[model samples]
Target: MLFAFSIAPAGTPGDSVSAAVADAVRVVRESGLPNETTSMFTTIEAETWDEGMDVIKRAVEAVQAHAPRVSLVLKADIRPGHTGQLRSKVERVEAALDEG
Candidate 1:
């Protein structure tokens, strides 16, 4: 499963939300799952829905600690028998571009 999500604190004073975002990313990093953090979202690969959601729940909680409310955007591609799609999916696209 490939779970991509963006979590952040809402209604903060300053324009910067980096501190709260960093906390969420920290939780994902410590999970030992296949993961990547980009400007807009963090993507993680997990074997089951429970495993993936647990990480996201904790990430939301991390951001929630900094503010009264949190905003989360999530997208998932769940394939039961597939693993390592996190990097493999991108590699396949790049390979296709190279071939073209």
Candidate 2:
């Protein structure tokens, strides 16, 4: 299986969330999954939200390695009032790849 995730800066740059995300990706890769793809997204630091799902969609296609299946992940925080649309896109891609 392939594991993927996207991350937003939880707080200040010194918060260490970015480091954790990187470490998580490394651990997932070390586990010996068939394929792995990671998309790191950063929104406008001033704007709370922006429509960047298109980037995620394209990144998945671009990063897919030579493997039977592609596993997509978004490491963004989905909290109250968050739409979590990227998560849906990731799942859809995973489903489409599996159907092939």
Candidate closest to the true structure, highest lDDT: 1
Candidate 2 lDDT over 1-100, as tens digits, reads 1123453333243534444445444434443332244356322111122323434444344333222334454544433353444355569899999999
Candidate 1, poorest ten consecutive residues by summed lDDT: 7-16
Give RMSD (Å) of candidate 1 vs. truth. Answer: 0.5
- Using Cα atoms with residue i matched to residue i, what is each candidate's TM-score against the true structure? 0.98, 0.27
Those runs of model 1 whose alpha carbons end farther than 4 Å from true positions after fitting are none
Off by over 4 Å in 2: 1-4, 14-18, 39-100
For candidate 1, list the clashing residue pairs, or say none.
none
- Give a tens-digit lDDT track for model 1, residues 1-100: 9999999899889989999999999999999999999999999999999999999999999999999989999999989999989999999999999999
* Clash list (residue pairs), candidate 2: 4-73, 5-75, 6-74, 6-75
Cα lDDT of candidate 2 equals 0.40
Q: What is the lDDT of candidate 1?
A: 0.96
Q: Residue 76 in candidate 2 has what lDDT?
A: 43
